[model samples]
Target: MTKYCRYHRNHGHTTEECKALEEKIEELVRAGHFRRFVRKDDNSFRSHHPPRSDHRCPPCDSRHGKRLNQPANHDPQPARTNVTPVDPPLRGIINTISGGFAGGGSTSSVRKRHLRHIQSINHITHSHHRRRMPPITFTDDDFQGLDHQQDDPMVITVEIENYAVKKVLIDQGSSVDILYWATYQKLQLSDTAMVPYNEPIYGFSGEKVSTCGYIDLHIIFRDGAQTKTIPIRFLIVDAPTSYNVLLGCPSLNTLGAVVSTPHLAMKFSSPSGDILTIYGNQRLARECYMASLHPQLPILQTNHIERPPSSEIT
Candidate 1:
């Protein structure tokens, strides 16, 4: 007698004895299909998976009422509001803008008001730009192709107006985005493209650097087929620097890019919620650093003088 299998509709074996049928059922169970048939406490067909931990931001100071470092069993006490509120003086109509607080009263009240304002702003921002942004994580695998032994600045290439621009330095220290005059000229943009900005920017050495003006350009950051285009206002400065452009905190914050020096890469989320990573060229970064250190000096020319050797000596 032959056993009949309902799954295979064959007489070779029963469904319980069929290896292929068993495998198919197991695969479906693992894929979360037929969940109603699965036993909750059955260890025989159970799978254990650890919970994922996604890091949002760095650990903030716990003194600011954050429960980051609080013990699991510790109970938080309510904030004391015993301080006498001091009413801030009213200001008259001022012609010029001056320093002032939006919230008046005691320091605690002011801080609470400020926090509320920040929270409301964040809520509005998130409501407008809500998306499933993949968390940016820098793991040991991100360092696979990088040279871990050397300290190199993140110098990567970007596309501006469909032109591939190189030697773009990612500088978190800089508050503003900068575009070198040389690079701007190479881009073949007209002078009229820039809006006249008279404000001079200071360098890292506190030297006042004059700017020609500023221009808003759409820059493309790409990782293979995935790309993010952002309109960045770049200040065109006529300064001698190895880097063609300096990407600063303004653009970084706008892009929400996380720069990892150890990995020598910058990662950010695209509009489609894909994580796009831009890796730095270590060789180009080193070359740029070396070029900045030893700038091209003018060649000294010696004027040839003809003299009678013996008569001139006498």
Candidate 2:
């Protein structure tokens, strides 16, 4: 038979009772003092402290005061506020008239670029106005050979005044209108003509390309069989590798053009008697365009929701 101690193995009490120790322990707990207690089984002895009085330490979670179902009291902290200073409203008024433009940040190179654009524009405009040449006939009356396979495109057309140009392409996708300087010289827009463009013309890599400038007199397109003519600030650029002249937004706005690439067409009309219409194969245009339509619906302006804006309708 197995022999057991004075107290049973299951109970935490030791086999040998220490009566005076038990008497003092209960008194300390009642007085809110921390106390340690130990218990063991027949196999081995292990020590552990029993929990103290009912009152919990602060920050401690318990069922008595706060309910178990109550959510934690912490709320997220607010985000830090921006503290950057903003420009004074009067700065525009002051800068607009004053000769000092970009202020301390203006670099000599940048200033020269601005001056060059101004001077070149003046030179091109002056030479174009003073030294005239027999005008080139710009006809956009439905080219017979232009028809072919095409993807869907949104088409728009309008007239830009006396621009002496057949078509105006407003590919918001293109960084800028690329023009051929040779075309301007061919127009008899002669020398003292230094190509003064210094600003980087952006391209596919989103990098600037070096080039010269020229004047395209106008834009011509079709609005449902009616011819349209629009006036524009045309740039004559040297683009030997590409098309003769490019019509960037500056030219397109002058012509009031609406673009449609996916369907491979565009629509425009001029005040002039000749109607201009074009149809193209998107495969052909891939060399020139990166279509810009987005997957999300554009937030329609309140006025433009039902119909196109007044400027567009005209």
Candidate 3:
């Protein structure tokens, strides 16, 4: 009697000798399931039949049945593309310009155009250098009523925010206008009206003080028939001072003013082609000077005087 194979169900062959079973084992090895048929004694599948020499891989159509020897599903190298590098038009123009200056085969029209462009640039630069401001001059009438004997600082009365403010000092040395905190409070301005100012101001005594804030006010300066209205930014500082407000270089330059200390008056050319003059308040200047000296005078007296006066009196 012929015994049949259990796996292939074919007669005349045992399960170990069946060719179909051998092919099934090779398929399982290619599919990564060869571990299931491995024996626990040797840790490997022991087949009595030899491996097929002409077996083809299912994935890559190669002669090797192992999956690792098969070719990859994707192409290893990327497809080549036709790409060309390009130069900018500005580069071409620059090359043309350099070639023209280097005495190359450049056209006369191109050379003439480049020369004209260069000449235009030189003409603009030359015109800027030639520009000049006319000299400023003053006449004898500019100092008509000025008295040098008064020897007062340039103090004037100006109208600010529709309020007549006195003790306004014209300080050419200062770069900004300043409104004393006390004077600003006297104007009855609301606290919300001031804008924040972070800049510090230095005084003549080399002392630095932080500003409280600033406010914009319409300042009206009158000189006889001439009057100029300007918007002034005043930095408010909480410091004791003789002057209520200080008119610095910013306001003076805006009005095109010229200050003469010897004359004790400020003169400026009005828009109406007339020279307007504002004179200093001699009496008010003296008063402020005395007030400024009062605080220091007491300190000086206390420091210098001694009890020798009582001994001299005895």
Per-candidate clash tally: 0, 36, 0
- Candidate 2, residues 197-257: lDDT per residue as tens digits? 4544545544445555434354445444455555544445554322234555555544444
- In the predicted model 1, the residue pairs found to clash are none
Error of 1 at 155 (Å): 0.5
Candidates 1 and 2 compared by lDDT, better number: 1
Error of model 3, residue 143, in angstroms: 5.0
TM-score of 2: 0.35
lDDT of 1 at 70: 34
TM-score pick, better of 1 and 3: 1
What is the C-alpha local distance difference test score of each model?
A: 0.69, 0.39, 0.63
Tens-digit lDDT string for candidate 3 (215-279): 98888788865788887777788877777888887778777787887667777766666767787
Q: How well does model 2 score by local distance difference test?
A: 0.39
In the range 106-173, model 1's lDDT, one tens digit per residue, is 16668587668767866657766675456789888788445788789998888876567778899887
Top candidate on TM-score is: 1
Which candidate order results from sorting by TM-score in descending order?
A: 1, 3, 2
